[model samples]
Target: MIKRIIRNTGLLCLLFLTIAVSQTSAQESSNLKEGKVSYITGENIYVRFASTDQIENGDTLFIRDENGLAPALLVDNKSSISCLCSKLGEHTFKLDDIVFGRTVKPVSEVVQLQQELPEKDVNEQVLITQEPTKESSRTQDINGRLSMSSYSNFSDEADNIHRFRYTLSAKASNLSGSKISAETYVSFTHKLNQWDVVQENLNNALKVYSLALKYDINESATVWAGRKINPRIANVGAIDGLQFEYKFKNMFAGIVGGSRPDYQDYGYNFDLFEYGAYVGQSKKTENGFVQSSLAFFEQRNTGNVDRRFIYMQHTNSAIKNLTLFSSLELDLYKLENDKPTNTVSLTSLYFSARYRFSKRLSVFGSYDNRKNVIYYETFRNYADEILQQASRQGVRARINYRPVNGFIVGASAGTRFRAEDPRPTKTLSGFATWTKVPTLNASLSITANLMQTSYLDGQVYGARLSKDLVSGKLYTMLHYRWVDFQYVNTLTNLQQHIGELDLSWQFSKKLYLSANYEATFQEQQLFNRLYLNLRIKF
Candidate 1:
């Protein structure tokens, strides 16, 4: 398995090298349009229309395809340059110059500015070319998958569980003119029993929907709007909101609704939460891309209880054998809850960055700070909180090195920062995952945390690892995790461990079945599961 991963990675590296070595235009365009780019803001580029009378009001701007022919967007007197410049770049921008969009366009007419006036009104389409450009496509595709697992122990009837998940989506686009699109997703999961008289369990659900339209107002920019997904990411790739994103130039701004699975309320409410907004930007340099974002959140019912934050991410590796990605975020909360239990308003800031020394080696570090609003008392979820002690600042980093192609070695030690309490708890975590192509997948992950909070319930240390073996039509997976809790002020001592394993068989590409077993070290036990997967795109 390790050898396969190595070989595959090598092939991918070679592919990237080939792509990096070749000029993007040469690789993607048959013939190039010898025009200049203007209004360079962040990652966006707008071509200024020149020397053409028909090129008025964001018009007369067309792009050349493989055939060496260009499409044009004639200008109109009513064109608003500001509105045009506002929709210039993004993953889902008005143009198809990049591969981020599921939809494609051919005319390449984005309206950013109008130097002249055309006979046609601003909303009227002008024909700058006798024939349409040779390069054009129309189609939009959306796809994704979801999975859930549960562990059960039938022996002591101690560890029992139940869970489920699902996802669905669709899209459509037109390349010749403005495009319209829509998509939605839903998911749910829950544990089965409370292990008779031992435990308690619950289930939850999540749903998402987004719609949008993009119109090239001219040759320089596109205007797009709709309820689309927002990119309010934090914690690397660990968090995001499936809401709206309003993008423009080197920046985009918009809102989103609830997003979740934040475990400890550390994340935006994922429930049928209120709306939020996010803006972002990316740029091209001699080396790589630079990305940044700002996000704001509101309650689903609209009152107050807002969680807003601005984050910046810089990515560059234009160098050799190295890549860098870092992020900084400040979270502001406007708590409106009148309940006294609701502590002070708070602001949390965090920063993290990682450097890849090589495909197999990299290191990362993170830091965070939190402060309460008004009286300056620490934001506490409960009494007996660490007041000044809750104001913690710490740094944790680790290095991952892979000497051989298949096996990787990683070690790390650091303190985990908690947002609510704003405290740094001692922690050490490490994980390694290896996938052997023909049939096996294995990973070992461990997390150790020693609470830094002041109360009796502050200490918690846990670790988890899982392994899966596969052969032909059958596969088996095993997972285990343990936690130890302790506190200085009180005897809130508890140690627990849970383990589970499951087997699955794929009868064919469209059919599959699976079962699982789960067990806890003591108290509760339960067996869980069955699964089915089907592919139907038509």
Candidate 2:
């Protein structure tokens, strides 16, 4: 199976390369669009622009640093005037930071627009694009990263386990001045002595996360084939067939028809077919923007309806210094006692908001409620108890305040509970950080956490210090944490001390190496873990 999948992937890759190399166009034009970081949540970075009409998913955004532009963010999702991106490499971004996007446009159009617009507006947000000579070549912008990592674990209670992982992610947009673009991310992982397992299921060792070819039908319509995830309806996961999207000014619509990956091993599964459609609208307000999407989907197993659901998402940031987002999913089909019925049930809901009170203070809060999603044909044997207890719902809130130039403190509290569940989980954590010490010139942070669950009560205390060894080239950090736990039923006490050391080096603009070592010491046992990774980007 691995060989077959690899052969297919290789052929597709070759075809893409051939097409990219053979295509040629007249003199190319370039325009720079500047945007600002507006909001960030976990891995999602939101940037606001005058418009994202020319931006596409997987495009790279560059950091507007004094030294020059460097690759910074990968566009993951976008609305009319905003983009949802993920950070690249180890770059750090904060609110209001400037970023730039390079776009292909006609030089005459840019010139005419600049002449029509006022001087102040053009100077503040846009840059003039000079016409290229007749001999100028089209830009085949490409971004890619290849990395390998090793993870090793050793403990006195069990045999050591070691695993290695290799991953490659690349995106080639507007290939060779053509409308054709391709994006893929693939990974291979295996354990040191797991040949038998790999032989049994090659899919387990090799996984093709995404491989898709996209064609821009026009300025407002586009189509994609192969395996790709539609960020507008991300909850649907990867679709293995075809996707079509069309935009009309601030309103847009999309349709997806495909088979879901195999439920067991995430491999291709033609038996599980699905289809969905979604519609959305985005508008830029005076202060920020508002976007909303609604989608309906139905999945089938061997031509039988396996599941049906509706997904809704909304984001509003029109209020200055505030942002709000929410999503909801409702199951429309269910099976009970061998009988199929259509009954609407809420399956998942999430809402979050953040407000920046001032330059030195901000607060964030979120609520999430998720229940076990049932598929009639997929998991028909699941027990009632198993479904009833499979709920994880929680609420969390945090506040951060910077008292001085280098000193900052923050705290967060969270709780999880369900209607029928007897025990609840609660957590409280706080941290104080000194970004720069007067004499040592190193960053230091102290943290404390308390957690209470049905099984045990625990407390953790930790501190970390980090410094740059060679300015922008090398860095290191040292951290120590102490943990104490008390069993609820056994009334037994346990304590552990953990120490970690981390080192990272940037050999060049595109090459990086990092290593981490951690050790945990208990009364009668010792555990050690080591991780190493090397990455190169082009």
Candidate 3:
């Protein structure tokens, strides 16, 4: 297995090198153009061009910032004079940043219609061809963040616990004007004072969240290797091997071949080989946009068929002020008598929608009929097992209303039903927030929750206050909550109180620090926790 992996990796590298050389040769023989950033919005940046006739939808654009040229935008929608772009990286920009578009193909390849034109038409054509030309250059942007956190916990029955965690995330792309790119996110945690119980679970203290490399063969097709999650098919989770995708107009198709991570600790293993394929389409309408995808996957455990399923997802915003999303998974393979059999069964379903009635009012709702995820290796007790096995069919709805400026009120309700369970669980919650207090530089919020189930009923009340001390540099928050629970069968009641304080400081544009302290009191016992984190971005 290791030899095969190495061989595959080598082959992919050679293929990418070949493509990069070819592209470089072609680019040297062609010309390029430039555009200028004209406007910026919360979700998109608009670029103005002399004439956007050469710009394509999937083309990439680089923005010149203080850190040099960075390929930080992707062109999504365009018109003859302007193009809409979405940011691909975190880069702050002001007005009139120089935007460099892709290299233009050779003019000889462009088709021309030769004819005897009128005298007036020839003059207009010559004027149109006299516009200024710009040169295209390659971009290399390396940026990411590093964070370290320390956590300490104190309890009555157990010894004081302390842990330190460090996380690193970075991306280096288009290095030296090549299409090669690599990204990784990894974290590790260590216990300051190891205890027997803690040591038993130390195997999970290190995790490699993602490590992937991508090679863009061209504007319309790309390939990726290693463990990475594809945004278009996020429901399928991470793929551990290779993925290839191609785009056409408003549609895309892709294939994935990989091995699933080990079941015990999410590490590498050859027994869980899997493969899948998906196709999707997206389009923008007069009102909004919509996208949908369908995928089929198969998995094996030690050369034996383990699971096969089909997944479907859809998202829509074509209706004014309304957004909708839904996804479904259906099992296509079942096991009987230690043999695989064909069957059709709905495994999971989820749907969510939101609508804005006006500038001051909005509502959102969601429904899910998926079983709760269960990890047998991590189960601690019978109650945990029971909760994992319980069917997680539930529906929730929330609404927010702003009666006046700087003040908002919201309410939510939810219910969950389990199969063969006579009693269902229901909950209701409400909150009110005042962003700008009359005489103070602080915001305040109050919330209440009521919950009922077959075994227990509870009520919780909470309040929080937050203030900005130094405009955008420093902030502080304080919160308190009270909870009361009543057991139905035993007719017993319990009460608890909790409090927390949080502080954050932004020292510079690329550095931040935060600290949190929390305490809980129940039945004459107390528990406390403290957390501190520091992060730096590049």
Candidate that would win on TM-score: 2
Residue 413, candidate 1: Cα error in Å is 1.9
Candidate 2 C-alpha lDDT tens digits along 1-538: 7747754675567456434433432222247776667544333356666567897655667763211344566564554555656443223455445578878646654333211211111001111112223342335666656788888888988899898888776666677678777777777788898888888876787677777888877767789988877756767777888999888877889999989988788777877999999998877666656777899999999999999999987766677767666778999999999899999999888777766676467676777675443331120111112212222248877776767655667777788876664678777778776656567776667887777766667777888776666765676778887888777889588788888898777676557777888888888889888889887656
**TM-score winner between candidates 2 and 3:** 2
Encode model 3's per-residue lDDT on 162-227: one tens digit a residue.
888886666656767687776666666777855553356433664555667778787667798987
* Model 2 lowest lDDT segment of ten: 117-126
After superposition, the stretches of candidate 1 with alpha carbons farther than 4 Å from their true spots are 1-136, 140-166, 169-178, 188-206, 209-227, 232-281, 293-346, 369-394, 416-424, 431-472, 480-483, 487-492, 510-512, 523-538
What are the clash counts of all predictions, listed in order?
46, 0, 0
RMSD of each: 19.6, 10.6, 13.8
Each model's C-alpha lDDT? 0.35, 0.66, 0.63
True lDDT of residue 132, candidate 2: 22
List TM-scores for all candidates, in order.
0.48, 0.75, 0.72
Top-lDDT candidate index: 2
Q: What is the lDDT of candidate 1?
A: 0.35
